[model samples]
Target chain A: MSSAARLSPSAPGLSGTGGHDDRKVPPVADMARIIGLSIPVACMPDVVANTALLHGYADLVGSFVLPDDCEPAYEYVP
Target chain B: MTMQGHKAGAALAIAADVRAGHRSAVSVVTDVIADIEARDTRFNSVTRILGPAAVAQAEEVDKAIAAGRDPGPLAGVPFGVKDLFDVRGEVTTAGSIVLRDNLPATRDAVVVERLRAAGAVPVATLNMDEFAYGFSTENAHTGTTRNPHDTARLAGGSSGGSAASVAAGLLPFTLGSDTNGSIRIPSSLCGVWGLKPTYGQMPLGGVYPFVASLDVVGPMADTVEDLRAVYAIMAGGAPVGEPDMGDVRVARLGGWFADNISTELRAGIDAVMAHLGQDRVIELPEVARARASAFLISAAEGGNLHLPRLRRRSMQYDPATRGRLMAGAMLPAATFVQAQRFRRWFRDHVHAALAQADVLVAPTTVGVAPRIDQPSIVVDGKTVSARANLGIFTQPVSLAGLPVLAAPLAVDGLPLGIQLIGAPGGEAKLFAVAAELQRAGLAACRPLEAGYARKDS
Candidate 1:
């Protein structure tokens, strides 16, 4: 799932202490290692799951490109 | 009197009794600690009872009153703090074993100190989602907090224990932080009153951070009056009555907020609208996108916060939370930047919509707490994990950083809640609306009673 139409129809998962599946859904484990994350092979399924979810969120925001004048919402300065 | 046996079971009631010599502060705190020990086994809302320290603080309140001095507005009231807030002399775990070895806090959180000054005793540290990350308080390290209304159900999370404790009548009120619906989700699930005040309106000094840009600490209680009183103290104001509701323009939210709701929730909103004579509805543009933006921002910010720790003890982290954080840390820089920019645009439109109404009414969650065994909620006709989808209605509003008060619908079935949203710095307006609902019996928390359960039993 990467965007609205591309969004994956969902289901509940990882029923408490999820089982280990070494299969990588999208090479997210390798990406984790690239970013200096020492993720275990057993965590491959979870890392993959997270990758898809984050990417879906990214795709949603990717549509509305920031205009030049839009202010960055950083720390809310009171 | 036992806290649960009190007529209102609110902070102000207990405080007035203690100050007027009707009850002793020592006895009140002691009775509450004992009651929690005996009863909280079903709810699992409390992590550590302050024990001797709590009684000691209560004793000071008794001393102040005995010496002919005012012991403060919240005199002798016992309240709990979510474990993320530093309690002096206690190692603030933020509900994780990883922080078990950290040094104890040297002093109390600013809010804790302020409450103590007003004679509120910090009786215990309530449980939370580790690092305040998840909506389901199913912490891998700490045991899950069960909803008091039905021990078989899940307590909405990150701030689950705080809301559950208040719902269980174990405390008058409890403080919880809302990054994105932590306070509201659990409050609604547990059928308690909760306030996620305008972002950055209150101090977050000693509270643990989840998404810094969106995090704000607030209070949950069994009554709106209690929430209003506690919020004032937390914001460094004095105890006050409900604000004027005159000339307040109320409207229901339509479009995305109007769809995908359970029948009971929809009926609850209709009942409220009918009571208030508000037929007008306001719609915000691209709300699904707004919700997605909040999700992305939370992941990126939370991922960055734990990146350093994940480098060393990644497996020690909760698998669910860890995976999300890892994914977020790797989120493209462009995505984070664009979300922030969208925030500016979305916030402007939300504010513009508010110019037409003083308060926006919307459902807090689709319906009641999901069963722990089956942790799923129905969203747009699909069943999704309650953990991920419980925040759908709440997250979109979080994007705008407006103030929201989660008032449990006065339904005898499973607890349902509604969001009373106000513009930024518009807490007074929200309070006024919530008070009116409470007065009219349209909104009231159904605190856990002995043998509380559905008839399906």
Candidate 2:
């Protein structure tokens, strides 16, 4: 891939206009509710902003195609 | 007793002086404590001084030497720990007010125990980002740690205090945990030597957990030699053998690693490549995705670790940390799982890169330390938060679980650094390259002048 293409913003979640499936991922506030977190009213804006940022990153990671045989990197010995 | 001109081997020299009765450990510890008390006001690097306990430990070392017994290799050298490490009889705050009321630790952290056993004394607890979450050490509970070279700029963190203390010559060495660029970021910005050892290499017992899958405790120091010596003690005292410089293969990481760097930093890397007589540049695939995976995993793990406490005392946590943790806790499980699976793929590719070269070179941060008032860096023509974006280079490397030695570049202005990356358990190779750079005058920690202190406040 060209450097310009690589540097271009690729996360649809950040733009909220294309390629994001809203039906699959709930809104930030709704997700918080489902997870049983009581985000404070004053803190909600920052929480939403950070969550939105993570959503973009999550979209980027989730879009990558992985082989079925791939396993999580969780094992650590000594 | 001053460490002005003794950056290269301060720890070893201090140990030799103590063991040979040239200086008493008690006196050394006392002088360090006094220096910290007198000099740390401008930097805000040291949060607590382990005065009485450190002095008592030094007395024991003195008695051991008097009885014709070995006091250990790092005898009487004073060091500090990032506030997350548990020290017996002290609260491990992890740099937040939320844990201020917690009970005192019953024992030292495993790495701290190792250092203490080796005759090194922990003289102070240094400042850090709350829960080791941020890159810039602008702690909400403790004030920000200022860069020693120029107090107006930030001392990159979550190991900001650890790096600053060493850079300022307050201590010969310090211990810090690196999950994602914590040690490397601070070390680079403060112009010190730091090692982010391979994952799972250092025992984490009694150390405050950050990201379970990623956390690795290591040492920061004023010189490559001191860093190696401290790392040996932390890694169970087996001395790391030096690799032949002639046989060590070097490559510069291009692709994502080559972007957003300053002219000075670019020149620095060019000089290093020239010195090694190689211009081979290796580009790793999917580096953007690798960095993203690390970010996701860290957030998810760190959020889960603090969920119980955050649930009870949400308001007590740092506002910046609390918001991010809550967001991480709410992440879809599928996203977290995908990140983990992608990590395996990324690690495989990184290993393949290592097969071609023994060591890979990259910049630790894009530029020098950001200004304190404006805590941000320009990336791809956009100004972003330094706290979140400074780790763009280091995070991807952290995902591969490689050992990276952050080496300070010898420059004329504010300090810059480069990462010498090696395969897992390839720290000896990293150390060899760092020593070569230091010897060739291509890399060395810039010493802060004695009169350099914050004048604004």
Candidate 3:
């Protein structure tokens, strides 16, 4: 049997090896509701990845890149 | 002692007398068992003793040794397996009353089998949080597992028994599983060494599940070498032979690792970094969110695993663990999926970042072990869950399925440790770094006060 079969309750869960399958994925909005922590702007990439395939939404074509002046730290080459 | 005996002691520094024929494994085990009997009343670390069976196993090892047979490296060594592990013919109570009348395991856990294959003998089942959920070992079912350093404080959980047993010298080393800092938290709190090897490097068969995705079995000992030895044996890998600590390149994880930790813990990390002469601190991005994501995944998966039990036997579990598991059960499946997906992204990012660094350092626990009922401590002027704070530095790494060693750092009288994390399947590298830390006076492990003396029979 495959490793997935060996695991309990074929839900899409993180494997011991740190990979994931499309089994029983936990709901994103519900999790945020439970955690109740602010979503740092630093987490945009994670948010994008987590939402890409939710409810058959395949492509997130918009660019979230900021203008060079948004943060002077990365604005220009020294 | 012969060569095999020498090999056994090499890890714990107990080999000198054994090799010199001062005492045999049988005698050592007998003395340790007696000590446990005397100390466990106060410590409550050992749930059930395998006295007769353990004695018999030790005698068998002695007989084999006398017959001039080599029993590999761990022959005759007294070891403890956490209550969550199945050890054939013993009730795997998992520190709960629900399994009080459960049948004994018909076979040993894979880790136990591997240890036995190397000639190690199982002595007792260590205490833990019921079903390995909580960080403090305040098991309402089984009495709390106390810190050996300060009985008034906790030994950190769900590997509380394993950590306490090793810290108290009841056993030289013990097996433990980490879902979220279960192994490392207690090891730090109790002033011993605990390794959470890269996930899946050690087999999980015969061990009860906590969070299937995050649970991993490793060993806790009083020394890094012992941790390495036990890891090699349990994982079915050959030892890295002799450690070459001089060549280790250390990584001091700053940013999220540095900001929230306590002054004492930060001092410990700083001391170790200075001693290693590679104090360049590197930022590990996304660690904060990663840790939060890990908590989300652990709860959702753990609840899913025990949903039936929660529905029927809710009252059986410790109230703290049961509540969390129930909440996890309520987590919409999408969030759990997002957490796992986030884990995939985080793992890849961590691997890429670690390619330039051999190991990353952080405080094993956010602060020192707290008194069992001491409530909460102020961290950065904010009040957090007393139990959750202890595992703050550890949860993120465990989520990434990376290896980590909670190696003790020097503290005045209280015990504190720094966590050394490495990429997946990097236990050998983690140990090599730990050995270097020990040499630099950043880490030390000593056997607990001699608990009992050998009785001449």
Candidate 4:
């Protein structure tokens, strides 16, 4: 709710952004485990911190809507 | 030949001489290799000089000319590739320690092979953001590629080395990849011609994959003609020649593309529009959302590519890229799906805007290159990291899958540029407008020394 909590990934009170996330964004530590279950404990901190930042950006993208008929731009001749 | 060392010579200048049999390709290669050795220390643009293999290729070109056979279109022109592109017998580092031990590529990237077939000698591998992930070429392993125009400033890249090398006049032309403005940002900062061709139009074979969907390789050069010529070969012969400029319907991009621009840059774009006699201005809807989609898609895709490696060697990546890829790898599928779908809608809007004009012009960067010590630009009056936010104008355009030529504006002081956007597969129309500006002296490549000369001491 406060500016500091919104910016800090470590803050537990950070809520869903733009009503796009059904659940509160995962805590940084939880995101690290979500990426690689067996990832080294030491690497988790960086992963969590990074994942938290990415989730912040993903929030911006999640707000936009597209029709289901719009196909992804995946190109390969084969 | 003087070799034009740091004089910001054009690739077309050398190709003309070699094509005419006036100068031996062998001699040109020898001199260029020697010149880069002599002059590249300042910019640190070149990572490794090809040496023996390049010399041998040059000799073959000389033999062809001596034997009365043509030496090809780019004959004897020395060029470089971003280290991510495979060069035969060289390890493609992609600016990381992670790939230092990977075996040498058995062959060249498809585009590299195309250039070689056209007689352009690949003399070296240039520096880049590790895994082509960062906007600044401040490679932790390879060292930051200092702007040749001013050693203390950022060159603005992932393709920093490619653009810097051209700006430094060490190479006439170079190859670089653009995902989220990699080529365009660096080209605009370093003041060279860079083309990010229509997405999926050019072959990506043998180049290291970053964001598979958005990644596109293109050429950077000191002259627009050379840029188009090299592109012709890369796109599979001579460009359908330059198109008629009179037929092009040009308009300046307004709204998101116009904010936070400097006065000099504003004048430069104003001059360009006046030169074209196009006073029209068009704005696309939801550009901010389009940029966000491009960003998320790139992160998710780039993260997925490096996920396996990160799981094993997370500590090895540049900390900046590591976190990004990790975040991307963990991005929810729903988010990625939303980004992709939004990409399609945003692209349609952009294309629809293009239907009214043959080309859309926007400032490549918010302003000039940022100083190295203070590596931030004032965007919308807030100082932000130049590395992450350099693509503000470019990222939105990338979503459209259109061809954009990064045209350096001939303004005073540090290098600045404008983006000339064309409709899908409309490279020729963009080239026509770019050529018209270059001819009118409104936009021209300002080599490093030329920019430094213009700098206020």
Candidate 5:
């Protein structure tokens, strides 16, 4: 398979909309659990704020158009 | 010829003196340690002084010289590394207390080993942002690194200590890692020369990773010559050939790079362009997105690197760094993938721009070092955290993986710097432009005056 094909989202709920839909996304707390991360109460406010900030950046990146041939800049070589 | 007292000479000059038997390597090492010990109290740039080992190494150089064998090109030159680079037998804290219990490195970082082979002694481990996360080197563990020019202001980081020590004349040169402007930002704010060489051009072995794709180690120094020498040694290659100034093409980066700069900085750049007699300006496309892409990528990569540790000891992390990492760790995989895809597009555009011009010049920071008391800069007419926003110009350039030479502009006030950017593996062109600027007196590292460290001064 081509690199872009491998990068395509195959999991349900992760494809098509490009993660821009707010409804499809989980809350920071829920996402933390899904990712196996435990953010403490004192750190939640900052984490939430930071996650919101990243989402803003993510929205900018996701909204851009890319050709089907546009592979990720990173490659894992072993 | 002992180099006693606080002020340090250039690395090349120190090496020459030692090689000529005018000065013993031991004296040079002892003098630098003493100067850093006596003077660093004001700036707090050094985290740990490698006194005994440095002196011992210097003695070896002197012994080699006495035996009529060449030590190396950088023989007897004393330098420091950002706390992240492993210095054999020293624990690499990476400016965090969490790693205090980690076992010492059994060997030196690859670049440090190369420098040692060239006869340079590692004198100290410098301060930095925790895990190289932030631009400001206000560490929760090691304390802040003050600018040598004005102790009241910040020395832009995560290479703050590296730049500050060089600017303060305590060390001839220092090693720093630039992921997204760690080397350039501090070098600019502190009034010194620094090079963030072509990404992946230098070895990374034993160097702590931060955003693996973006992380590159380079030197910050008192002069372009010194920066070039240290870079050549670290790269394990002969020095880059002298660039033919007549053949080098140069242009200013407009649009995104042109915005958010101070009036004096604009004038300084204008003067440089006038000196070069170049009028062309190349504006990059989608720089905001490029910077945003770098941010998202760094957050995700950095967060993932520390996820395991964050799971067990998040509380021990710098409060400022942990939250960002946790948030990054949870970023939707789609976001990270998108950023990488966009990066490919941006890199192509940058390479296309390089095809038209051999070098591109941009402001390293929007202005001089922001005062420590008011750690903020006005960007897009809004006051933003200087710690995060300082890399406005630098972060975008990093995404493309090109080499950048941060040159300090000669000004009577605090230091301002400009980035002389080049195509990948095109450091020679950047060096030529920087040398021309230096020769014209438009760019030079402003030396701190004697007794400037005193509070009353």
Candidate 6:
């Protein structure tokens, strides 16, 4: 078997990955805090569509029934 | 199907034992905790064990049973929740310290409520990648969730902990959310059965969102029957009644699903088909462009949701994830909008394709779990980003919001599974077909026993 067929404790890094070479960047103590809660990359369309869906729903329900948090630009609280 | 061996630790067995007065619910739950404590130290599958609450809940279940009330389907069975999901009285950490001070959730996520109603006890909040971002559960914040078969390798993520916990018998079944294959990848890596119901099959109210459209909640279990039981309760829809298994038909997806898979994966799929004596192979339409479109939408929306946080605390995320999110933030708005339009087009196209087949079959993941510390995957001698590789088979399906079940192939010794994709709202049919596969002995569904690991050379 080739060398790649053998198992290692930690898998090797990619053979040619040069786009972003910031491997030596300083580590942040609170990564989530620094990164902030970004929406998951997979859910963008759903969020946009859902926002529109909620907006359309709001028009029918009127202002009092909807929480201000339900507005078009409401940040998703995880 | 009558309790054949130790591998079949069915909820039915536990219930039977309790009804026969051999043990109490408290005893079963206490033993499950002991099992987790003893085994998890080696597996590191669980992030946090819910000791006190589980014990108290077990006692309450025992009391209800004593009062002669049937405690529903999962009565007194112990299970775990993916940490991203909120549990009342506990902070939904989503595998990061940023939410350490967040107040406890006031209500259980809808799935959690359903499980509780069925008398299943919550054993712990399992680990995951920070905010369920990565495919390999090598959470810089919480440490990686290791595969039960080989501690040195990854437990596929971002539902890595759920799969690991179940694979290690820490919980017989657990709930996980999938956005582009989190639930399925881990389940495949850990050698367990998992289902990602059609989008919105189970309520998504209390779970932390990854990609909202692609995100879905489902169960991961040792066997398809257990998965069926948990899924029935979790779906909160009237039980799919009894599945009509005899009439079930399996379709092998050609096009994208057939290409780009590891040789090992192809071998496994071939073995599953060969064992059945009835195999159908067809070419499927290419899905790469749609997959990329899904990725574009995931990035743009995710970046926008956390734009303020990204701006204020850019240094806090795992460098790998932060860089990706940053790229998303730079994505033009029109591209993001166009991706959605493309999703509609893709969904319509797939719907037309499915009209020719009841369900599409493909490998749940392109390959086995990568080593936990790896930064990328090498497929066909070409290396790809580890995150992107994990979403290979899952994204196209999730983009269309279709239902899929990742069924472990019993004949394969490695942790590999096959994806059975059904039309939207076809979870019931998916489960029935999975059950037939399980009964045929082509797929087996018992949790891996403790201390079972494949040693590396």
User: Which candidate has the top score in lDDT?
Assistant: 2
DockQ of 6: 0.05
Q: Could you tell which candidate, 2 or 5, scores higher by DockQ?
A: 2
Residue B307 displacement (Å), model 2: 1.0
Best by TM-score: 2
The CA-based lDDT of model 2 is what?
0.87
Residue-wise C-alpha lDDT for candidate 5, range B359-386, written one tens digit per residue: 9999999998999999999887778789
**Model 1 ranges off by over 4 Å:** A1-27, B1-9, B239-243, B449-457
Comparing 1 with 6 on TM-score, the higher-scoring candidate is 1
Task: Report the C-alpha lDDT of model 1 over B270-339, residue by residue, as the tens digit.
Answer: 9999888888999999787788888989999999898889888888888778888888887778888888
Off by over 4 Å in 4: A1-25, A37-46, A75-78, B1-9, B448-457
Q: Residues B323-409, candidate 6, lDDT per residue (tens digit)?
A: 556555555555555556556655666777777766678888777778766757765466766765777778777777888989877
Q: What is the C-alpha interface RMSD of model 6?
A: 15.4
* TM-score on alpha carbons, each prediction: 0.93, 0.95, 0.82, 0.91, 0.92, 0.81
The C-alpha stretches of model 6 lying farther than 4 A from their native spots are: A1-78, B1-9, B274-278, B282-286, B373-375, B450-457
What's the CA error at residue B14 for candidate 1, in Å?
0.4
Model 4: TM-score, first chain: 0.49
Model 1 scores a TM of: 0.93
Docking class of 6: incorrect
Kindly list the per-residue Cα lDDT of model 4 for residues B1-457, writing each as its tens digit: 1112222236766777777876777777777777788888888899999999998998999888889888887888889999999999999999999989999999999999999999899999999999988888998888999888788998889999999998887778899999999999999998888999998889999999998878899999888888888999999856876678888999999987887888888889998998888899999987766777777788889988888888788788887788778777777888888887777787778778888998999999988888889888886566767887888899888877789999988776788999999988889999998888888878778664322111112
Model 5 CA deviation exceeding 4 Å by range? A1-26, A76-78, B1-9, B449-457
Best by DockQ: 2
| B198: Cα error in model 1, Å | 0.5
Name the lDDT value of residue A73 in candidate 1. Answer: 83
DockQ of candidate 5 against the true complex: 0.35
RMSD of each: 5.0, 3.7, 11.1, 4.9, 6.2, 10.2
